[model samples]
Target: MNIVAVTSCPTGIAHTYMAAEALEQAARDAGHALSVETQGAAGAEPLDPAVIAAADAVIFAADVEVRDRERFAGKPTVTAPVKRAIQDAAGLVAEAVRAAEERSDTAPAPSGETAPLDTAPAPATKVTEGAGLGARLRQWLMTGVSYMIPFVAAGGILIALAFMLGGAEVAAKVNGGTFQGRTYEEITDLSALVEQAGYAGVLFKIGAIAFSMLVPILSGFIAYAMADRPGIAPGVVGGLLADAIGAGFLGGLVTGLAAGALVMAISRVKVPRALAGIMPVVVIPLVSCLVIGALVIIVIGQPIASAQQAMTDWLDGLKGANALLLGALLGLMMAFDMGGPVNKVAYTFGLAGLAAGNLTVMAAVMAAGMTPPIALALATVLRPKLFTPAERKAGEAAWLLGASFITEGAIPFAAADPLRVIPSLMAGSAVTGALSMQFAATSRAPHGGIWVIGLIGKPGLYVVALLAGIAVSAACVIAAKHVGRAVPAAASGAAAAEAPAPSERAATVA
Candidate 1:
């Protein structure tokens, strides 16, 4: 059989090429002729157009956008984040191949014998168009989360190192502009000060800044990935503006969509062909950035920042009942969206609150944010074949990432079965969030898993909260899946009860 594939990742870095190699190797191993396309920093290139023309199936292993889906219009295809292609390439390809066979069987016949676009059925059954908004959004967030993982891990380590080495110095660059005020200057000899000044410190600080910028970057790139060149500039600028203005997830989401739309609009406008090459890189970015930046700053930024501050204060001031409610919301946001805007809001607030001496709130936020992935990792461990062999392997790999507070490690499972997986993650995350609040665990570091214990107060309680949350999230996922399955079975039974059996004559005629 002939197969075609496209591989892409946001950074056009390691994962992109890795997935491409995996797909190519898998196709060869399966004795299938294959054509692969890569959409990278350079541009799109089909390995062989003729192979695509003759291919029986297509695989899009991409985190970014594929330029034109129209070319593969009728072919059976499987789409997934690029990392899946690398980590589980052979299995993913096998699944795609099997899906292709099913598609060929179920798909409508070609319009005519000359129909080059085979018009095969999709691999999975189509549901209501609106069925999985949460799942898809979660998938997008997971993509961002995965990409952001390295930034957080690296930043956290640098922060830890700063504390260990610098040890309580009130240096000038250590605290940056924030230390200008005596309020911040008096912040005990924690030596979180040395992080910004040391040789490697700048790199670590940059990583921290990058981590903070991650969601907006992902949101923008994701829009770009989906919408193509038209989407890149607007998405990125809008994301940055959203961050500057304090527009949370909702705002970032709006900006992401708007950026893509803006791109689409520009693409429709007629422009000189000679200028086309510069449009995406130069013209588009300039115009789109101006428009998006204005909209965010003027329309959305101030209100969001105000509201976020207000919410942060309320949570900080919480004594008993109020604390519980705030904790629930923080936990929900942390796990609900992974590292999306909602997650960022809670996390950012936590970090900011710590600077303001509201350590308890920060503790809750970190605890919740770290729980989902770790819990999901554990779930995969316990269930074994509940996940594919490749997924199980990825799950094991996630342990290190999860320990380092990299929530992106959970993306693989979430992408594979979003509906069943996320809620499980959220349940654990919420429990962790709530437990942290109850214990009043406090942390100074913005990012770190359990390793932040040294930088935090009440380390034992923090650990307890972390473990509790993980347990709850894991249990929730397993139970939720079982419960969800029953609902589907009930629906099927009800459908069966309402339908009449076919008569022998009718059956024969049919």
Candidate 2:
């Protein structure tokens, strides 16, 4: 069979490409022609229309809805989550082949006159895969988070830039005396802002606008992950209500889940073929939104707002020892896996706090995350003999990686000697985290590591904490190396040949 397929994951980074490769390999093994589009962070080129038209079947392996889904309309299609494709690409290929054959057997005979390219968008046959409830929920939330990150980076960096340009006085004016938030009604003309605080005011306004979308995007995409495109409207509208009512990110989480659940339930109610086309586009979104709006307004709003406020109050009231302990815990998480799931958890928590006007969490998270790569790089420099030639090369790159807040640069070293390197990195990161909190070195930016020093509240203190962590981690690495096996430089040819490349498997943290 000839198949046209699209693969997309939440972040559209590693997994999208992985799934595409898996499907291609599966198709080739099965003696089928396959055209696959990978929709990832950098975006994707459209597959040829002719190729799509000629395909016997379509495969949608995506967490988010397939863009331009109508292009595959009326095709015999098989749909599964992107991870499913990675896990069982051969099964998906076989299923697509079956779907194509089934359609060929059932579809009406070809006629002289052709139907329009854009016709009723039939729901693709969804394939179920095994995963626990907890795993599925985590995957769904990650879907939301992955989509939400670009907004965080762009908005947070722009706000940081605004502060750099306008300084304290401009921040005071634009923030309406506090960072908790300022009303949209307070927005003034760009010309007027330029007259007042120049470019800084304009940037702050723009950044603020971008930051405002954090909740809706998170909610919408979470729903999108569960129910694809049909869930977006309800989820986004519910999120807007959540934001307006002071329910914040917590509320966004609830609404996203609720909207997704509602859409799924609605989709399962068997409608006539005549109504099926309209169901996804109109009835599902309309009904879900109306119910969700009512639910938020009448049942959940006040309680969630109160909880959000209480959490904010607790964060605001955190004192020396309490703050230090929190920072240390977060730091440990940051360095625990060097930009793996644990690191992302810490990073995501920091982002949540940044949105809540609690800047210290962001500061502590970044400082701790920066520790591992910097420390590893420093160790490689101080004891070059302890590392292989390739390790040394990786270490050289780690300096810039660590500085830029890409923690996975340290992964190659960790993979080689996890027992020694990981603990030391964690210890040093904890120290940095505690100190950052103690010094009250705050940052509005979610990332940009050392480069964003100018925007940090206590830039000097932050640098001092970072350096201190680097020193401690480096010392620990040197001490632990004494117990490890001989360096890769001493390895036999086959052993050395089996080693993985430093850049190949490293994860990117936003």
What is the per-residue lDDT of model 1 for residues 1-510, given as tens digits with 9 covering 90 to 100?
A: 777888877567677788888888887888877667888876777556567678777777765446665566545566656777777778767866775675565544232211111121111111111113432343333333333334444544454344344432222244432421333332234355344356544544554564566446645744543354456577777877775665544455667667766765876677898997787678877887788778888877667667667766665565345676677778887876565545766777776676678888887887787777678778777765354433455566566556656565565455445677777777777777787887778876665566556777788888887888888878776676565322221111111111111221121111
Error of 2 at 373 (Å): 14
List candidate 1 segments past 4 Å from native. Answer: 1-75, 78-173, 176-203, 247-254, 269-283, 313-330, 333-366, 379-426, 437-449, 452-461, 477-510
TM-score of each: 0.55, 0.46
Per-model CA lDDT versus the true structure: 0.59, 0.69
Residue-level lDDT of model 2, residues 1-510, one tens digit each, is 799899887678888999999999999999999999998987798999999989888888876657777676557567666877898999989888876775565433132111111110111112111122432454355456545545555555566567566653455565444333532223355556776667887877787677678778878867765666677798999988876775556567788889988998998798998998798678998899999888888888666556545544454455334888988877887887664445655677787788777899899999998888889889989987776444566677677667766575665566445578889998999999989988989997666576667668989899998998889999999888766333322121111212212121111100
Best by lDDT: 2
When summed lDDT is taken over every stretch of 10 residues in candidate 1, the lowest stretch is 120-129
TM-score of 2: 0.46
Steric clash pairs (candidate 1)? 65-225, 74-119, 74-120, 168-189, 428-473
Q: What is the lDDT of candidate 2?
A: 0.69
